[model samples]
Target: MMLKDKMRQLGRRDFLRYSAAGAGALMAPGLVRPARAETAGLTMHTWSAAVDTVQSHLSAFTAETGIPVNYGNSPWAQYREGMVAKFVGGAPLDAMWVSDSWLPEWAEAGWIAPVDEFDSLMKYNAEAEDFCTQSMTYGGRQYGLTYYTDYMAFLYDEAKLKEAGFDAPPSSWDELVEQSRVMKEKGIAEYPMMLAMAQESWLIEFISTLVYSHGGRLVDDSGSAVMQDSKEGAVEALQWVVDAVDKHKIVSPACVETGELAGLKSFAAGNHAFAMVAKYRLRMLNDPAQSQIAGNVKQAMMPQGANGSHATVGWMRFHGMSTQAAQDKARAENTAKLIEWFGGKSDGAYTFQKLLFLDIGAGFGVKPLFEDPEIRAAYDSYGDVNMIQAQQALARKKDTITPWFGEWNDTNGSAWQSAILGNVDAAGAVKKSADLWNELKDSY
Candidate 1:
């Protein structure tokens, strides 16, 4: 059945029910009073999961320091715009959820407090250090704290590939194209891979990975726009997608209308042999109730570029304290204690284990979680695929962890989407994106 047809059969209540079931796995015990309310009047702005996670660990924090959390839960979209408005209006929150992409804008606006001031608040492991330093720092000052990190990688259906006579996965971009072609020819799958190109977020994912894989940098040291508009490497990388849809015909037709969630669903349903997905999709693929290819699903690092670089896009969400919030040294200390109790080594390990069991995706920022025997064992069952992906990501020479400007989402994102949709040639699309980026750069 067409994905669109399947989606039309799904009612809104069905999606809500699915979400409820998913959340049930992570739901915490009801809120209980701390022994002492050290931070009696502090409020925080974040998404619902953070609130739940924080609440789950509140008891430990209370035992350490009595800080009653006045937690606020808002959707990510609202948090960014609403928090900015509140901060600009002089009604800043004590702390809020901040993603890596928002760092430049928020840091430049001076709305967030320096993380160094909260040194005693939390501690990060070495794995966190290996992630990305620029994510939390700006102007030589740390402005945010990260609890989780996410990246885009390829998820594959191991059983389906074996059926197609492949004992191993593709190692390079050329190999991916060749294998995808063979997968289609053998009737192994309608489309071997599902690429998320419908929404702006997915478009960014596609472009960021392609650019990085091809030894292309989106911005220079001084934050100037720098993409190759007429390079063979860039053209070759872009052509891979063009051929996937237009030539090899290995991508679903619904790709134009499918969003991130829908693409994940298509892959989980065993309609595609592989998918370009966020770390979180691991969970969906493991849920026997939701996935047809349960044990068959495995993850692999993205294919290498012509230059032999293994580049993938890293996306992270961070936490930041508000500058306008009244500073209560005692309350801040208690909040820090709470963050540490939930996001520190022990909690991070727990989160990683849960993620592995649920296959929801990879843990956000903590790398040490991989060292856990159970975690490593779970991934090992998939035949070292996860390890290879991680190693490739680590081996990549450059990382595009710079803060994205507002115009980036509005302009560059749109142009990339246009190219993916076949509305513009690759060179034309990149040149347009570069021009828009330069314009945004000058305005800043």
Candidate 2:
């Protein structure tokens, strides 16, 4: 039976439940109590599993400082928008997770506070702190803190490849095209890939990876938008998205409807062959209770460009304070302390890394944890490749992202989506994306 057939194979559990292990821990009442009754609770914005991981470590903050933290999370694809909406509406936000690419715009707009403003905050090791920080700083004021870091790699089922008569995974985009065609012809996959296209920014993650993999620059040093009309490899990257749907038909028709979560679930359900793997995805892929493909899928280095080179995005999901923090110095101080606890070498964040990274065979940005014996053992699958790839990717990551990333995607990514859906031709889509992106760049 086909992998898609297995999702409805009757005896198998529902595909919706395939990745349930990644769900956030229950937000229990009184998980944290303020040391003083008068202390105001802080509202933090984050994504679901990430929030659960943080929630697990938050008791230390509550017990020591008496700061009560209330968690608010949106779907990962919509998180930046949710943060922006909160900031725009003047809603209460003490500290929240913001991506590196989105930080500059927020900081420029005065939507977030500098982490340096907090007193008694924990200090980060120079190395670990750098994983996601290079993109978040603006005007010399530090505005973000990252506890866990990751990268974009490939995840595939060795078993599925064997079923399709392959012994090794594709190492280049050209090979990926052929391999995916074979998988479809062999009935091993109905859709050769589960491409993310529904959410604009989420779609950009996949596109940016392809751009980098093809040795293309998505932007320049000044953080300007450069991909649309450039002779850079980005054109080939965007063209591939169009071809994936229109010509090769290697991607699912549902690409226009799938977001990250659904794409991940379909992969876990054994319906798709390749996925753009992030650090935390190791958890979902290996959780037997949550993955039919558990133990069968593993991380592979990202495929190289047509030119035998590649580029990549860096991991930096930083917790940033809101401008509203200035309203109450005492509460802001308390919130700062919590954020400090996150970046510190102390046990709260270390514990978070152990669960989110080490235990799940994922990687993090913390320098100290890399020395731990157990942590190294947990990541034995990827070996030293992660360290090497990560550093190189870090150096190039800034070129592909800007503070206006969220806005640029809305303009450009939507056009790419139109191309995928056959509503517009590839050249028309690329032109539209460029024009819209340039407009956003000039305005913001």
Candidate 3:
């Protein structure tokens, strides 16, 4: 029978068998290696950083447990689409890397298995708890395991700030504006800020931080869209970005056409004085091969809002088992073991640090790793003044966990982008976005 025809006839048990068979075929060559004996053969789909961190450490895992790892790497944008297709097509996959943002959608679609069954194999890290509450939870049940976390912060050129006569970073938005104005007048920098307004994801991130810092929620307790247009604070936040571009003139004109990486490149090249960027970019700025401001970079919390509150964006990446594999149970167990071993201390947080530097996701998922003096000093080399402060900011930030319905990104993120890019007025954008959000909530 054809694959699709077979899929229609198989029961869950048979489907599991078929899925594992396909996965086994994919790993047949690698299975001959003695190290894979314990796993009964498992395959994983992950992004590049996982290859660098976890996959690179597979030999160690084999030495300890005798289970070999079969891993594949894909780009971030393709990982989700690939998994969704496989799940819906009834193809077997043992486990794959996923984004926390995808949990609601995938869980609701019944595309993933709950990781709670493997709780005994996993040790809870406080950092993992923080990620769980913000990224992996849906209606109080955990759907996946998170191994990485990230967020955006204000990155600046220390030399430029000092030349502009500022001894410390700005404490509030008003100070940021003032500092930017001075830097502009002094010609210390051509543009005071480098933001990726053109990149939709980055734009959403930038606006989300502003909205939360101003005491706004992307969606209310009822899971209905409420903040963007209805809240005064939300409107003001958008207006702040508008003013930065039009009135303050502190933002680069290139922001209109800049992609996320370009914004980082601009800041690192010293073409701009400051940037609102992911914390991991700090490492890039310190790499002399990639940065002109290698020794002059510094990191500070996102500036406080009108209410004296500062908010940051919490981004996370997760791993989940695919229902499509032949050896479903063995695959799930082996994948769990991999996560626990790599993220656990016995591996020495090697995967965690590599994730941060590679920008695979945020590494703060392991909190104790941040507390390590050696780690902190290395991050400090990139101007992470008191690493704990960045961690604290991430902890305090509002992480609005929207239901991971497939349409959530299309509805909410697109609407917010419309407002940020001037495609829709603030009220119009919010109303349209909220309408779509409420529709999704009602369906739920």
TM-score winner among the candidates? 3
Over all chains combined, what TM-score does candidate 3 have? 0.81
Model 1 stretches astray by more than 4 angstroms: 1-39, 121-127, 229-235, 325-335, 345-362, 377-404
In model 3, which runs have C-alpha deviations exceeding 4 angstroms?
1-39, 50-52, 127-129, 229-232, 323-332, 345-362, 388-393, 396-424
Better of 2 and 3 by TM-score: 3
Per-residue lDDT of 140 in model 2: 69
Q: For residues 340-440, could you state the per-residue lDDT of candidate 3 as single tens digits? A: 66444445554544444444434556555666676666667666547535544454323445553456555655665566566877677667766776776
Regions of model 2 farther than 4 Å from truth = 1-56, 65-93, 117-125, 129-131, 324-336, 347-349, 355-363, 377-403
Q: Residue by residue across 1-444, what tens digits does model 1's lDDT show?
A: 999999999999999999897787557444333323344455666765644445555544555455555666777656678777777776535667677667777878777766666555335634464444456777777765565666676678999889888898887777877888888888888789888777555666676776666656566767666664545345556666777787778876567678888888888888888887875666668668889998887777777777736667676666677665426665556555544554453443445224423343445456555566776676565436355346435532123334446556667666655776789987777778777777766766
Name the candidate, 1 or 2, with the larger lDDT value. Answer: 2
Candidate 3's C-alpha lDDT? Answer: 0.67
lDDT string, candidate 2, 49-130, tens digits: 5555677667667777676787667887677677778778777678887777777788888888887665344256365545
Candidate 3, poorest ten consecutive residues by summed lDDT:
391-400
Q: How many residue pairs clash in each candidate?
A: 9, 2, 14
Candidate 2 lands at a TM-score of 0.76
lDDT (Cα, 0-100) at 263 in candidate 2: 83
